[model samples]
Target: MVSTIVWGTGNIGRAAIRAVAAHPALKLTAVLVNDPAKAGRDAGELAGLGRRLGVAASTDVEAALAAAPRAVVYAASGDLRPAEALADVVRAIRAGAVVVTPSLYALYDRRGAPPEASEPVLAAIEAGGGSLFASGVDPGWANDVLPLLVSGLATTMDAVRCQEIFDYTTYDQPDVVRYLVGMGQPMDYRPPMLAPTVPSMVWGGQIRLMARALGVELDELRESVARRPLDDTVTTAAMGVFESGTQGAVRFEVLGIVGGLPRIVIEHVTRIHPSCAPDWPQPHSGAGSHRVIVEGRPRIEVTVEATDEDGNRAAGGNATAVGRLVGAIDWLVEARPGLYDALDVPLRPAIGRLGRRGV
Candidate 1:
């Protein structure tokens, strides 16, 4: 069994805990949290599993690493504090633990990743003989794996597009929705996500990944953004009132131009309230989905809708991303130590998980 440590107890961490418990080959060895309030709590309870997992969460990062777990689920939020997140993963890698995370966006495409992000991580892997893979749902599977997988179905292709159609009303991340994404903020309040070149900085790698897989080089990368203000005020159960005229919806794309056209695209249509952008892309029938569209001879379109716990798509998406990460731990344990991208890892199936149950 691969002894694993879950390094965060937030949204992603909650799912990581349950995933580790359910996987036949993974033993839940430790849960590390920076939150003092969460320290010493049972992993299962923190994961909302309705039972104690015996393994308690700890505030001690050093102590957890000292045990030298075979795998580390680095689920800490890297949205704001990316440097610190990279450092944490580096520390874990240098400890000889195979690390998987959704934290490092820059390294999603190792070849296209900036030298600053890729160089240090490579050094860490060389020093410790441990591997690292950075992926999640949007930047994870939907961005690279799902789109590229579907591209194989096309006889001939003109363009490939990946879309995230999500309604964040039920999503509990207010700081992300309000501050980071500028959902309820004024139109002038530009969030870090939509800042010039930031979208390209964040999602441009996925486009390059697809291009590389197709054995073609991108001519250039571009970003386009559009935002809409609410026609009226709205109230959400999770985040309280959002005044009218604030930013309500956003549609943006990171385009990978090949030859002379925008051939590869990653688009997102995110709404704080459904009424804001009636014309923009909506989820198939629910709050969220990852959709792929290939404009080719056959014209293929596929959508992924995932739900977890109480039918929450956001949580479900996170769970699926965790599945991709946790599901690969066993493979990483035996593979040569190095940095890897989604394309380097196979989406292994539930070989022994047919009857698995969480504690």
Candidate 2:
């Protein structure tokens, strides 16, 4: 069995641990954490699994690697310190462990990254004879891999568009919500005459991945952002934890160009307040849903409708994203040694079934 080490105890880490523990082909050997408070506690308990797995959380990365794990899944916070987090993954790879992470912005656009960002990591993996892959839920799955999968069913194609629209009313992470939806500010707020860069850091690679997959070299890529506040106070079990009036909304549009001309348009909508639907064909009109439209000789559309148990859209999105990552672990291990994006991997739905349930 392949021995695995899971780093982090957050949402994604917990889910990955649970999944790894139950997989028949893999063994959960260790769990690494930065928090000293969590050290020595059972991994299952930290993940709310209720049972004991005999494996405890520890901050000692070297000790975890000494156990000779076959792979390491780094699911730590990416926003606060991505470079540091990526460095940790690189270290694990150099120690003869395959590394997979969801950290780092612009992972698909390696051209835009500084040589210091990925070169060392790639070199270390090669030196240790290992592999590394970085991907996010929306960009990794829906936009890049999913579109490529759907395109296989078509005879010809013209354009591909993927969209993620979710209500952020139940999202409680202040930094993430603020970064994604442009909260804590007025809708009409503007920079002092200088054009501000929209939050393309979240999904810019999704657009670039699609362009590359279609063999379309983009000449230019542009982003536009729109923000608004809730007209009325909205409360939910998850949102109730946060003070009211702190919620806001944002819309992001990414226009992709081929041969100096616009070709693909990708949009993402994140809102913390209730509002009217936009002028487009949405599956649920107002409720949280994601849709992908492929405009070609044979049109194809796929819609994903997900509702949180507590009706928190942001929580549901996070859960789904974690689930997808858990599902990709096995395939990630089997992939070739190199820096890989989501489109570089084969993402068949059944790959998820290979892992344990919660993973």
Candidate 3:
């Protein structure tokens, strides 16, 4: 069993803790948290695992790394603190811990990522002789693994579109919902997530990764965005009220054009409420679904719905992202020290550590 430490305590971090505790090949050694309030807290309690796992959360980076964990799941949020998150991951890597995370978005498809963003990671990997892998639900699985697997069944593929259609009311991140995603803001307010070049910077790599898997070079990477205002006031348990005339729904697509045609597309249709978009595609299950549509001879459409313990699709999606990162731990440790993206690693389903008592 590989000794592992979980970093961070946000949505992804909580899920990683649950995963690490349940994995058969992994022994949860320590958890790293930047928040002093969370310091010395039981790992199980932090993860909502019901029973105590004897591991306590620590605020000391050097001390946690000193434990010499074979792997570390760096689950901290990079949305707001990209540089800090990068530094944290590098610190873990330089300490000889194989690191996996969804924090660094640019690392999702590192080939297309800028040198300044990815080079430091490579340097750290070389310095520590430890590997690194970055992945998440949308850029992680929905675009890379799912699309490539679905495309394999198609003898003649014309276009591939991967979509994340979900209602975001269940998600509890207020800053991200209001500021980053433009929720509860005036229609004129442009969220940083949809700002010029940001979508291209975040999702463009996923498109490029898809193209690379199919052995096709994209002529261009294009971005398309559309927003809808709420027709009436809406309320959610997680986020407060969103008044009418404010941004309620958003739909955006990152298209990879080949020979002047969009051959590969990564689309996101997110809304604060289900009633917001009558015409937009709806999730087939409880919350939302990740749909992969291959348009060609014998067109194929596959919809995937995932849920967490309480049946919250948002949390389930986060868990899947955590699983992708943690599941790759064993494979990553065995591989040579380097920066790895979704395309570089096989989607080995980490199963042994699942279904522990009350987990």
Best by TM-score: 1
Cα lDDT for residue 279, candidate 3: 92
lDDT of 2: 0.68
Query: Residue 69 in model 3: shift from native, Å?
Result: 1.6
* TM-score of every candidate: 0.98, 0.84, 0.97
Q: Top lDDT: which candidate number? A: 1
Q: What would the per-residue lDDT of candidate 3 be over residues 207-314, giving only the tens digit for each residue?
A: 888889999988988899999999999999898999999999999988899999999998999999888976988888667878899998779999878888588888
Model 3 error, position 359 (Å): 1.8
Model 1 quality (TM-score): 0.98
Alpha-carbon lDDT, every model: 0.90, 0.68, 0.87
Clashing pairs in 3: 22-353, 23-353, 24-353
Candidates 1 and 3 compared by lDDT, better number = 1
Model 1 agreement with the true structure over 157-215: per-residue lDDT tens digits:
99999999888888888888899999989989989999999988888877888899988
- Candidate 3 ranges with C-alpha deviation above 4 Å: 351-358
Candidate 1, residue 124: how far the Cα is off, in Å: 1.3
